[model samples]
Target: MSDSPENDSIDYGNLMHDALRLLIRNVLTDVSENGLPGDHHFFITFDTNHPDARLADWLNDRYPGEMTVVVQHWFENLDVGDDGFSITLNFGDQPEPLFIPWDSLVTFVDPSVEFGLRFEHHSDDDDDHDPDPENDEIPEAPMEENAEDDTPHEAEVVSLDAFRK
Candidate 1:
């Protein structure tokens, strides 16, 4: 057999994926400590059905495939770590906290700086889509309690279509 780079050796896509993921973790860490500065905000889209994703019961019914969240004005208990991040936001006059692992996240966008990233978290097949089930190895619990306070707040739903043009 001839020695070649494509001789069933390295997975370049997987390597690049991991490197790009690190960028997200770094950005999150900064936000967790210093908080978002100026007009900077994030439009994060993630797989709602991901094993590590913990959202309110109602959200699953609404967004079965994926859900995008705007991290701008109204959010609480923002925590970012090695594995993932968790934050609480108000929806329909109630607190909805969600835990989303890095592996679960499909997109991360910052409109202010025109920075965006899209990760392939799912397979092409309509069926047999196997997401990385990190939960099987590590047990997890909801990060924040359901706050009864009906704080009226809203998160902007940014459309990427505008940027495309």
Candidate 2:
């Protein structure tokens, strides 16, 4: 673990993080082209005020910290790209569109498949950022649920501490 030139040459962790972000983009791209399969749905949590995050002024005002949205049903205009994705979801019976960059995503989870990814963001506004609590920004009211769903929604929390040094 010397501070030699070879050891300090490049940042491997950053490369891995970038690669995972690509994976997320790829997954979203695929889901966009060929509709989501099975009981699969996504719970995406991201920083609302991130520079790359795009949404209405009211949205930013409402959710200034962390905001989570369900991509189960009633999502429209899902545009996925290399940098990020934008989609329209219902917010209290109104169509709300949100564009979020990969770097701003705090967590992506598919509870049905028990698959999830948690990201630790290094942002300029980390003064009061509290991403430790799962579903920290969940809406107070219940969102539109599946018509055939008898089971209640459940969240599977996963830790990313092991990946951090």
TM-score of each: 0.69, 0.69
Q: How far is candidate 2 from the true structure (C-alpha RMSD, Å)?
A: 10.6
Put down candidate 1 lDDT per residue, 110-149, tens digits, no spaces.
7788666655333335375333432112111111222222
Model 1 scores a TM of: 0.69
User: Which candidate has the highest lDDT of all?
Assistant: 2
- Please list the residue runs of candidate 2 whose C-alpha ends up more than 4 Å from where it truly belongs after superposition: 1-7, 122-165
